[model samples]
Target: MSLDAEFERVSMPLENPFTISRGTQTAAENVVVRVTDEAGMTGVGGAAPSSHYGETADTVEAVMPDLLDAVERVGDPHALHAIESELRAVVEGNPAARCAVSIAVHDLAAKRLGVPLHRLWGLDPSDAPKTSFTIGLDDTDRVREKAADAVEAGHSVLKIKLGTVRDRELVDAVREAAPDARLRVDANEAWTPKEAVRKAEWLADRDVEFVEQPVPAENPEGLRYVYERSELPVAADESCVTAADVPAIADRCDIANLKLMKTGGLLEARRAIAAARAHGLEVMCGCMVESNASIAAAAQLAPLLDYADLDGSLLLAEDPYAGINLSDGEIRLAEQDRAGTGARPAEE
Candidate 1:
């Protein structure tokens, strides 16, 4: 049987751009993809939104007509290669658009197999994966306070969104607040390699994990500059969107930040992880403001990653569907059993 691609726009307001100091976002402005085959089974896909990462509702919306027009008639949506090709031509490194198409196809395929997405992706394991909660940049006192509360709430790892040149104060506040928590910082292209070094120096060995995308993606030289000088390790976020980047970015960064939005979806993300691993780079799965449909798809790829931050759903003031169990920083597979793309959150 054949499959047809369907697309729609959804807007879910965020309680806050899920503040990490780099920027702000109001809603989960997203593109929802559904691929229904001749057998009446449907697969779902979700796209993550990030204006700072160079994605917008307009870009997502604008890309859809062309994407659906091309892939709608593909003879085999389940064939990963074919779907990938159509998707790359349409969405590519654009994150949001690519993610939806990748997800819809995977969702359809998983539904056909009658298995949880994780099982289909070979990411299912008995133990749940630990997920890092975020601490958006706020006043020194507020940053400490939020970290304390969230850490007490059972999140053991904290990913701090550090804006330009604000690293010292935020890191100090976080360290003072949650001394025992594993810590990483995301610059979101806010700092230069030199500034990143200055920032990482303050918390070099004291309760600091790594620094991500200290500079912008295009400046791999700056990333390498930071990687060579910073006391803490550097990871690539905006600097990496696919497997192709892993080799080019290998020498410049110690880790790679793989977001569902960035890698497109679970399958492509998994392949990206393999490529990252092969280059001897550690992986961290990240997310933007999205629903559980996106989180669950990325969750399947978490086991293969060294770290994860799939808390985008947590930032939602309200989530319509209950997709997965994320208790105390753990993502359990309770929601993976449902049919149709394992996007249990989309069922609502």
Candidate 2:
């Protein structure tokens, strides 16, 4: 039952400069984690530390030694619950670092069971929704071009980054480019309550499905104000970080957007989903910019989600690891042939 664990930092360039209301990212900094059992079976996971969440690659690397120590001390990869508890105990704040180990161990455990991670959880892959391809903020024309290209590439769902002075113009351009595509917009907490409501009116008129995080998390009342009046459904991304945050946002948002990096691990993400559902909210699983090492693991939870944004690796200029076949935005989980999270070095 002995296990060996290790990690490595990776810097992956984006296919394009990804911009949100908060800022832009040209690259994704990830730390890949590997957990190997006595039988030489290895599980892979990744930490895509986000500075927005008070985590960076350096922070993840700084804490890996203690996290791995906790894993080895626990010694059994199958003891996932115990392992997660140990990881939490070892590092109180580094959810990204803890998430890396969590993914790796889950991957290993699933491999040992000779099943894909979703199958291990007994989820029906057919229920999984097609993922949304994100169109990061750019000039209106460029945004339109990206939307058209995405539709041509078979992406029926597009998540557009909003929160600019010309939000209406950008939405107009995208709608013109892909009139039939399902559109969702994320303001990333960039608007005032009244402004969000006004924008939401026009956004709804344009057939946008939902408006995500229209106001800052700090202004709970503002979020509730917009949610109570917006023409479109509201989804809480920044406000709903963990399971504990769900109940507070339940009355304010129609959807709870959970990210693995924000929730820390697969188990915690599940808990958050359950909590959100319990509070009568739909669930969406999102991701930070990441490699397949982590995105693959996130994809395993697709069946349990109402929405999916697991396109992190797809946005990468090149991903050294490959997992899942998200051809044309369909999360072809049942089509996968490998065990575990299906994440492995691409060279393999």
TM-score list, all predictions: 0.90, 0.99
Name the top lDDT candidate.
Answer: 2
Clashes of 2: 0
Question: What does the lDDT read for residue 256 in candidate 2?
Answer: 97
Count the clashes in each prediction.
Answer: 6, 0
Given candidate 2, what's the lDDT at residue 46? 99
Candidate 1: worst-modelled 10 consecutive residues by lDDT:
339-348
Off by over 4 Å in 2: none
**lDDT (Cα, tens digit) per residue for candidate 1, span 1-348:** 566777777778765546655556667777777778888777777777677668887888888777776667575766777767876776665777877877777767777787777777665555445888888867778889888988888989888888845567887889888989998888888887788898888767666888888898788899899999999988898888877788999999989888878766566777888999899998888888777767767776666778888888887877654566675788776555575444655346
Q: Which ten-residue region of model 2 has the weakest summed lDDT?
A: 322-331
TM-score of structure candidate 2: 0.99
In model 1, how many backbone clashes occur?
A: 6
